[model samples]
Target: MVVREDSVETKHEAIELVLARLLRLGSLVAAALLAVGLTAMVVGLTGIAPRLITAGLLVLLGTPVLRVAAAALIFVRERDWYFAFFCAVVLAALATGILLGRAGG
Candidate 1:
């Protein structure tokens, strides 16, 4: 399809779209990481070695923490206050769990 220059939108709109898509992609990746982490943690906990389980839990927790920080950066740049706030809260909760898990271990 042939499009005219005047018929197209400005660079800023395209940039915004790109930023939002990037954020969405990040969110998806984070979600996947969290899921995998949780599964590994569960498997380790139920399996033979206690040390392995603890290590698995720690690694699993790290992925979400990383994801949240990355997402927050994107949200802040995009001026998405709501998303930023949500991710912040989620990160805090995950951190607390990590701390408690370590303490208990």
Candidate 2:
């Protein structure tokens, strides 16, 4: 069995590539949804258009959050436990804030 070792820089670069792809994909999906929503609205199909718009907005909002989560997973893969733990903590805090905000609303 052969195990290859990667330097920390290489690990970070790998994660960056993954994050870039994720962002690009998220942007594309959000744009498509927004376009559809706009078209629907223009054509007087009011029912689903607003829902699609909201969904697109949500995807745009969630991209960075998902990126952070992916970073945590990549850290775990690279055996960087400290970074992984901190990222997890950050995610937890974000989730708590969202929950609290919703409850208050």
lDDT (C-alpha) at residue 93 in model 2: 98
lDDT of 1 by residue, 1-105 (tens): 225333334322444565566566655665665566567667764443444445555655555456667777767755668989998998889889889999999
lDDT of each: 0.63, 0.91
Number of the predicted model whose TM-score against the real structure is largest: 2
lDDT of 2 by residue, 1-105 (tens): 123454566545687789999999999999999999999999999999999999999999999999999999989988879999999999999999999999999
* Candidate with the greatest lDDT versus the true structure: 2
Candidate 2 is scored at a TM of: 0.84
Candidate 1 CA-lDDT value: 0.63
56 Cα displacement, candidate 2 (Å): 1.0
lDDT, residue 10, model 2: 54
Q: Give the TM-score of candidate 1.
A: 0.43
Stretch of 10 with least lDDT, candidate 2: 1-10
